[model samples]
Target chain A: AAGVIQSPRHLIKEKRETATLKCYPIPRHDTVYWYQQGPGQDPQFLISFYEKMQSDKGSIPDRFSAQQFSDYHSELNMSSLELGDSALYFCASSLDKGTGGTDTQYFGPGTRLTVL
Target chain B: AQSVTQLDSHVSVSEGTPVLLRCNYSSSYSPSLFWYVQHPNKGLQLLLKYTSAATLVKGINGFEAEFKKSETSFHLTKPSAHMSDAAEYFCVVTPPGYSSASKIIFGSGTRLSIRP
Candidate 1:
């Protein structure tokens, strides 16, 4: 089975720079969620989209913005990146509940972001 | 508010020994709980989930979790530990309101190390 796909498995950026991470969800999955995991910490929920619409938001920073495209893929764009932003970014996808029952997300290989 | 707590930051067990990872959750409403595993440089894999159907949920790879509402605990357990099971495990919770959107909160990960 095809799993979620993430771009730029590893990224390095300097402070005050900008970066974008992309996620291609599994086929037929209409919900996408983003999470950030700092070293030795838990994965924190950032934001989520359902059927191309922003459905919920968590602790995502103001400098970060995300959206799901018509293709069901999503992107997280960060600006004025700070050293504290360095962490692993993960994307997960699930079929929306309109399809019935509860939604259980499946995650993709995460992108490791390093700020220098 | 919804949150999950992983009681241990790390656990070590010998091969063939029993494995236990403790988790506790707090939610305003009925919650859906999950266990996910992450191997080094790999994506998160869903081990099992509790959606109010059964108290004892059996997952893949002989892993199982029991949802005890009265105790507010959903601990993952396995009969025997394997070297391949050495990885980080996360306890996750999603409140009823956001279940459709698949928004979830994760606990601080517990890194499991297996000895030969």
Candidate 2:
């Protein structure tokens, strides 16, 4: 089966501009998540969608938002990009969030965004 | 609330030697711990995870982690360090149920280096 896939492997945008990144989760997955990774730091949770509802969010700014479609695909949008927004964005998915065992998340290749 | 901390910023080992990456976590309830590996310009990959069921967890690529509730630690280990093992590793912790919102806390990350 094909793993999660992300679009625009690399992106560049000017300060104050808006940028969007897309992700396609694995088939039959019910949960989709977005994460951001800065240089020399671990990946941080941005937001998650499960069953078409916003389940959780991390310490991201209000300018950031996400949407999950009926097909379980997800999109992340960043408004008024800043230099601090330059980082790698990853999309992950899981079958469910059950605590029975390891709800291992499968990730996409990631999208590198540069804000100048 | 939940948080994770990686004890080292970097670790170096000779080829064929054992590899150890230390991690600690804090949680208000029973925690779900995980270890993820990321190569340069790539997305995160699951190494192992520990739920409430077992203390010792084995994962792909010959990696394993032991969860110690008493010490609040979930440290990853490997019998042999391969050159391909050079990458950044992250320790993550999450609360135990749907009410926890599936939110995850990640550590600062530890970069592994292998000597030829």
Candidate with the greatest TM-score versus the true structure: 1
TM-score of model 1's chain A: 0.97
Worst lDDT run of 10 residues, candidate 2 chain B, spans: B96-105
DockQ of each: 0.59, 0.53
TM-score of each: 0.94, 0.92
DockQ of 2: 0.53
Residue B104 error for model 2, in Å?
Answer: 0.8
On a 0 to 100 scale, what is the lDDT of residue B50 in model 2? 82
User: Residue-wise lDDT of candidate 1 within A1-116, one digit each (tens)?
Assistant: 99999998999999999999999999998889998988887788899988899988889999999999999999999999999999999999988777773568899999999999
User: Candidate 2, TM-score vs. the true structure?
Assistant: 0.92
Model 2, position A103, has a per-residue lDDT of 61
Q: Which pairs clash in model 1?
A: none
- Which candidate leads the pack in DockQ? 1
lDDT of 2 by residue, A58-103 (tens): 7677999999999889999999999999999999988774533236
Give the runs in model 1 whose Cα sits over 4 Å from its true position.
B100-103
